[model samples]
Target: MSDSTDLPRFPQESSPGPTGPTGPTGPTGAAPTRPGTVNGAFWAFLAATVISIVSGLLVLGERDSLADAVRRSDAKLTAQQIDQAATVAMVAAVVIAVLIALLYLLFAVKLRAGRNWARIVLTVLTALQVLSLLAGSGGSWIGYLSCLAAVIGVVLSFLPESSAYFAAARPVRR
Candidate 1:
């Protein structure tokens, strides 16, 4: 008689068969839902960044006005000095605008990731922006629009839906 050991294991010895239903499945968590506020904030920040870049370009375009303003503020400044200062200011503004745009993007990403600190930081920055806009003499429409976008972003971040998402993301205490 053939020994049982001569035969391969049941499944291993058999030819491939039709696949059957798998075993019990693990719990699947609820589907992730991105809040509208987060999306709004992201777009608003992007808009603000574009507006800031445009405003910087506008400043460069009106270099003569900037130099004149500087001269009026400081009578001792010669034409050459005023021109130099205007150039410096334009360069500085461009650099600052780029940096601000990058900062806004970072904040938007962090905020979307449910970072409470990012939300707080963005709110503080928005408040500072609004304050600065209020304190300074207004210029181009771009500046006002940028400030408005910042304000909208801040508001959206504090909406009830946003708050709920943040709360959900927060770790629960024992």
Candidate 2:
């Protein structure tokens, strides 16, 4: 057998040299960067959340009309019952709006983090909103505007740059 000194050694075995640099590395790249489309989507979601809250407030503001309509449809309802029903309806509307706004914010944060699942979920939600807008006729302008904002957010999320960023952010398989 040849002497150990005659054998060629690999670079790693030769020495414990200093590494070039140290930094964080995710499945994606060195660092995450926010694309313009993502920024637009974030703002759109925020606007949609605000619009939903305002719409709920408007519904609350029209409590009298709601109670009158309810009373007209059901003549047997006493004044106290009518008032309770209107208050319950307004409270339910406000709660639902708050929940939806919270969901929008959650999606915005996840999307900003380059989560592909969040993008898909937001897209699906936007589609549902569009369908609801098309099927309903009694929605106020605020509802329509919120739908428009959702559409814009979805559109921006699907832009070419956004797509590329999401692709780059995908988890790398070992």
Candidate 3:
């Protein structure tokens, strides 16, 4: 007679059933959708930057005695100072344009990717732009119109559609 302890045990699968320790179930939800506010803001920012750079370049290209005279009265700069200022302004404009373009691209990517931080960043940036437009006024025809256009752009960007989009993109509480 054989002992019970020597009897066969439960059969196991050849491949070893449940070979590893059990793991908890994964998160039970999908990620949210991207918003359009990011896209619109990105486009507007890029376009504004490009326009500013192009205009600056064109203005710098036209620098002559007329430009010097204009700068002398408008900026209280001497002839030599005007020349220096023009060069500085041109370089600054191009650099700023590139930087703004890069920022816009980053903003768009972050907004689309649902980074959440982009919403606050975009809001602050747009608000700063609005303030700049108001503070940079010079009462000149071109200056006034430029500022007005900026104001309009900023205002339109706050429309319901854009607002909703931005809200949706905001970070969620876990």
Residue 143 lDDT in candidate 3: 34
Worst 10 residues of 1 by lDDT: 18-27
Candidate 3 lDDT, 1-174, residue by residue in tens: 989999889876343222111111123222334335445555554455455445445555655754566685776667677777767766776677667756755764565454546645655765665576668643344334433443444444566655554444342324
TM-score against truth, every candidate? 0.73, 0.82, 0.51
lDDT tens digits, residue span 65-97, model 1: 889889999999888999999999989988998
Q: What is the Cα-based lDDT of residue 76 in candidate 1?
A: 96
- How big is the positional error of residue 131 in model 2, measured in Å on the Cα after superposition? 0.8
Worst 10 residues of 2 by lDDT: 16-25
TM-score of 3: 0.51
Segments in model 1 whose C-alpha atoms lie over 4 Å from true places = 1-32, 75-78, 172-174
> Highest lDDT, which number?
2
RMSD of each: 10.0, 5.7, 10.5
Q: Look at candidate 3 and give me any clashing residue pairs.
A: none
Error of 2 at 157 (Å): 0.3
Better of 2 and 3 by lDDT: 2
Model 2 ranges with Cα > 4 A deviation: 1-29, 172-174
What is the lDDT of every predicted structure here?
A: 0.76, 0.80, 0.52
Better of 1 and 2 by TM-score: 2
